[model samples]
Target: MDESNNNIKEPEKRAFLKGAGLSIAALLVGGLSIERYAVPKDRSVPVMDNFPLAILEDPSGQPVTTSEVIEFAGAKTTTTSSPILVFNYPLQDEPTFLIALKGVKITTPNTPPSSGFAPVPSGTDAPMDGIIYDSTTNTSILAVSGICQHLGCVPPFLDYHPGQSVPFESELIGYKLNGAGVKKWPDYGLIYCKCHGSQYNPVWGGRNLYNNGPAASPAKHSLPQIMLATDSNGYIYAYGINSSNAVIRTHLNFPGGETYGSGVKSEDLTGGTAIRQSTRSLPANLSLYKNTTLESVAPSSLGTNQSSGAIILYKTTVVSNENKNGLNWKGTF
Candidate 1:
């Protein structure tokens, strides 16, 4: 019985040795496979995105300036679109406007929002980059390119907010208060990009203050401004290139044809309306708090007869104000 047990143990040991030799052979042959299954240390992935203010090579081989002659129906004058239009006034030697023909539209390149840059749109073209100046009013003029700053999608002038539109909210991150000092849902303005719910401020430079979009976001940027131009003869032209580049002489033609509108005169803008109100706001009140008693502290009774409160309201009968961006207030308390 002992001899038989020994014989069984010898066979078991031989089987174990065979299995171990096969395992070692497999390990040497499959070493690369083990490494292939190893976990990766860097998990970061890159994404492709568009940028606003992307410096395109000024439209490859395209003329920096162009000229075109078009006749508007019922108008006796013929307007010539030209780069020379930028220097309409002797004092203003640069173009400050871009005019689109009646139905024609212009697009800008893709740009990041935080960078205040937006992707320029495709399919729209202007003989000259949109930049213009108005000699008649002594004021500069510019128009928005139809493209959205959030994505390359062009925004429409919808009567109401689009379903997917991005509403402009505060950048303060937390809940915001309203003008009434009541804590309210954050809502500032309507600058919705429906494709991805990115909201912007339309009145100010197109600023992306809210985000509800893809991982790729806009940088700290604003919409690239398209400049417009007006010649001495009142011809309006638009181009994307800056006015400082060496002049390229070509007749800038509007492929979609030209549109025309008589600019509103300064007097016409005011409609000769009578000055019924003032445009002056009072200075802020600066009164220190007073300690009335051991148990009572009162707000300074000092107040502005003109305006007072958390926000100072002001009204004035103004004869004139030289400051262009100054606040013009009117009210009676």
Candidate 2:
């Protein structure tokens, strides 16, 4: 995406030489107090060990500057419900698409995640243009690959109801690993691939086969989550993609073969080094990756009557992120 980092005049690149110290595929449990009580499952984000200083590069392989906000604002021509738009990023193959899920409700916690980006949904309608700075529900824009995870086929966005739109193979029946890396089935209506009926979460991490697809396939069941970053001026950047339970299907000829069982563990096909499982992740962790830098922005209302921190008023889809204790921490490192 050819975005201009014009909104916020940044000072300079804030780089760290050392750990400054501490960090995702699923939280590095070596440290950090793992709360034993029944906390909100989304809060159990993976705290990586490495710093989030990764360089964010666009598809052209150019270093993404803070001014990239210009492009993000330009991409949204109109605020259509669940509009599927593209942000040319990573350039690994193609630009990532930021699909807007109009009505699906997700959980939004009271406080911002210490990491910044968490699976919190503002539960508000997405702006036609520009990123919605939501400190509350946290998720408003979900960036993902337009390609289907089944066989890299480009899929169509369908209406959830049958007959009016394309019919699904059946009621979505599938399961995926949650933040805790536990497998369970979840239903994210409407956003399903017409190509193979592979349903996924239109928001958050863009899970693959949250309902099982095909007779039986293998892998961590994840679609690539386009890593999203926002600037101080309410700009959303598609810098990279995130994938999990990485595996390479080399020999489909021998699906049951012993050698085929232990396929290759490939690194992410994204341009950015840092990875986040879902929006519930601490956005700050992304800054720890090298090559890129992110300065957290407070929630800013888009071009709406509602004011800052008042997103709840204009909310159409409210994703609740309630903590077990029901307290709002300052939510910072």
Candidate 3:
């Protein structure tokens, strides 16, 4: 976790408050709506004109580079064994959960056929379902999509403890029930949806037991795994994701089920059914995008707070017109 930078130190911490809402139009170079953007006068980098791109003179725009390493304790601040840590970037839309699993048993750090682990959803034989490491403390980080598939609810990162109601317990973890009406879990690795009790396993990375919930298909709902990269200096960078094109504008879609879709705040209902959900590890997802698309970028320095990595937003599209700050593309539960 080296904080020493080869480059010169930037100015003091800067605050750039990004609008949490996404308009129908993306960030175009000129106006709010991009339908009538001016064509570039110059002929060089023609495709670069396609995106309304912005670059920082310094890391002035980065949000997570501070020295604020969110510690293990939560609202209580007492010692506890909560399974995961959630870093919420309210400014970013769609699938907004940055989860770090606290004590997941890792038989291997490199790849799988992982011992003491279940099968994580992947397209190939070698499944590197998402798992990162704080090698310093041996903690595994799971920066999973918070948007639930059965419905879009930001499930809590909670410890599983019986005989304790969710509200009375200050453990920062939850004890939500599954489809089978079971609330007592044998482990603490569940990202339990409060809306409809859609339970997803971060331990196995992108594992969904639809039989455990009321998802239409067998294991249809899966948490979207985020892509992350880290320099030897302990900087974890999130650049991409493998998620469903499914749009969930409201969480009321599947009410009364193991999970329900209800409007998080004032989000309008957008139309798109989830095809499937699966979790792929950061390394695996990165490889999939790279191998298939063969994209590359020259190296450049990004200013970061060093506490967390600012999300590297590669793409975003407005899906619903319900509110001024409409929802962006989201994953199925």
Candidate 4:
């Protein structure tokens, strides 16, 4: 076998942080006793009535222009509670141009974007970032956070041949199991974690085996995904996401904990028939809203079929709340 043919892609470098004794529970938005369920608002356009809506004005208090996009990573850095940012206005310092972002992915970009952008290390707490290059549209500037949602570990990106076979050891690029039962060699994605033997997918969104890893179901849920999008001007925006969801939350508990009811934090009970107690760190139980009912009997009996006789049903198909254990509440919405 040729040595060149044996070259394997390395796993993306990941960061890790100690989270013991910390209240990892999610902050219930707007503060309410029981979680309230509501249909999501349209995110296609600006529907939020909150402050800091418009991009912060530039010094000398002038708006940004197109030429400015070429400078300082495009328009003014936007901050919002909605998680997604945009750059639709023109820069005051440069040529006039428009920039807009839809959801997390950049559906549009202006001019030819950069070919390849490097990751800028902002700070210890600053989320890891990356850039995307799109040739089809002639735009390539993009950025995203690189922290892993599973236990606050960072993911290391491995560069490998796109369409070639590689060695398992050379390809070993992530945390793997070692010692009695702990993480060791947090390098070389081996689909094994030294800390807990938690297997991870090598190709983005890969599968995880071993205990302490996300369960197998809708395999897509195995990997944490970063939200990304670009504006009409070519600047990219990326966001981080938690991996736990309704389906996966169950796997989050210690084998002896309570099985019924949904939530994140669990109490460790060593007794027989032990029940797992949960803390506020988990998502609320599955909630259902009445969306369907028996059609009007009058229509059938009276032989007068009308649109009112039909019933509709609305259920939560799937939700990954991100905060706490997102996997705690999977099922029919």
Candidate 5:
């Protein structure tokens, strides 16, 4: 009886082993087939075409010239009331700052010497590479990406702070006028980010001035500059983007991939509808820490036409106090 039981057990074990072997072989074959089909046949890098030259237009469909920007921004010392101009270039959803640094004359490829600060490496274009100059008045006009390099904050949270005019948020974050005591900040107007305290020097190609402060610059790269040009008629046009290696926030193709060289990725440029025109208007009072009141509403005609490929540039009036109507105060002083 023991011998008969052993014989039956051996045959059953053999049958089970045969079945397991077949299952494992089938799985391996299936996995190989899937892998073969899943591999992309074309692994070539995408061809990125150069962006088309887009004319900067105001809300009224008029071309925005360098002279107009200089006049609106005024002189650096007296530009306390001038509003930050906003526009879209290359793509409609990509908001850009159109700034004239008051009395500052920005020269091309304005990369500062690497004395104590890390300058942009040689062979790469600096933020000033995109500056447009008015030959008649020698006024310097520049456009930089409005999106914060840290966390993609838009205007108001990532706006410019002119000299002598300190925002409540700026003072709270330790950015003084001219960086008086701050070792990290520059001694001039900065494109400051209130979100995480990233400060960019407008005079030095939107270079990030990060070191030691209550709120230091969290961004590792400078703001991407938009290449500007003027026709014989003095109309400013955005032709391309400089600082191609510095990726624009929210404009990345892959999850964590490098941007296409030559200042822009053609695939990204064509992803969104191009904004044909933008108007000079006040920024929205969206500060959670402060109460804002609309002093004077911009023209409703231009504001309502935002869906028609036009952007309303909201003027930012950051004040020292909070709970005030129309005053944009983001933090305590």
Candidate 6:
């Protein structure tokens, strides 16, 4: 009886061990499934969508023609200033910089050098054709997001530095005329950010033009270029954003969970109330301060439905730049 009992107990122990092993294996498989489906893959490509085409409008609510942009840019350039026109597209709250590169024909093969950070979405590594409208002269008109990629800073802080005219911040940060300094600055003016000194070369598809300075660019991506088209009537229209890998600043163009929506980036257009027309043009020579205010004016005042605002311009008074310590400055209205 004892021998029989031992034999039965041995078999029972083997069967129990086998069942436990199978249960553990099942749990391991289940855990893997959850992990695979729950968490998104890192650096997953953003879902690309074509935003609705918007007509480019002036402050007067009229269709802005290419010829007009060129003419305005020429007028500004004659005074050693660059035109920085602000308009909203694809979304009401998102402002874009509509600029014309005077005496420079922006052509194809303007692909920016890879920074080796963000994964370049397929088919976007090339130049965006038909976006740059040839003005029948050296001028070429294009548009880009006004928001800085380093931080979400807007106009006046991220305005263009035209030709040889360097911003005080740009000068301190080592940008020089004709690329004369240790770090070469482009001959054409860059889109400079005074907030943190980040710079973008608009000629090179708004690529980040990093400089050697204490306040180097903290941004990793280039400015998203706005796609443009022109009708036979010479009217320019903003159709969509360039389907490039460079994501728009502050638009939540990241991977993983859906903030805007699952795999829907164009839905970002839904949140902000659309700006009806361009804001008043600010001159490049005016001294800009962090405390400068935008006083809103009634739509009726502008003779349009667009709510307009004016930036109070100031002149800079530099006290000293002794010892190359940076400019000691004050603003006077």
lDDT, residue 311, candidate 5: 32
Top-lDDT structure, candidate number: 5
State the lDDT of candidate 4 residue by residue for 198-313, as single tens digits: 33332221122223322221112233222222334422222112112111211222354223222211211111110111111211111111111112121122211112442111
Q: What is the TM-score of each candidate against the true structure?
A: 0.24, 0.36, 0.41, 0.23, 0.58, 0.56
Badly placed stretches (over 4 Å) of model 2 are 1-80, 92-95, 102-139, 155-188, 212-220, 243-333
TM-score of 5: 0.58
The number of residue pairs in model 5 that clash at the backbone is 9
Native-to-model Cα distance after best TM-score fit, residue 188 in candidate 5, in Å = 3.3
Going through the candidates in the order shown, the clash numbers are 56, 49, 22, 67, 9, 1
| Model 1: per-residue Cα lDDT over 270-327, one tens digit each | 1111111112222222211112111111112222111123222211111111111121
Question: lDDT of candidate 4?
Answer: 0.20
For 226-283, candidate 6 gives per-residue lDDT tens digits of: 6665544566655445544355645543343223222332433322233222233322
Residue range 114-168, candidate 5, lDDT tens digits: 3433322342222245566443554457678776665555555567776656667
Candidate 3 segments whose C-alpha is farther than 4 A from its true place: 1-70, 73-91, 105-130, 155-183, 209-219, 243-333
Ranking of all candidate structures by their lDDT, best first = 5, 6, 3, 2, 1, 4
Which regions in candidate 6 have their CA more than 4 angstroms from the true location? 1-50, 75-81, 108-127, 178-181, 206-215, 253-267, 275-333
1 or 4: which has the higher lDDT?
1
Question: Which 10 consecutive residues of model 5 have the lowest summed lDDT?
Answer: 5-14
Q: Per-residue lDDT tens digits of candidate 2, residues 28-54?
A: 443332111111122223222111212
lDDT scores of the candidates, listed in order: 0.22, 0.29, 0.30, 0.20, 0.46, 0.45
Best-fitting candidate, scored by TM-score = 5
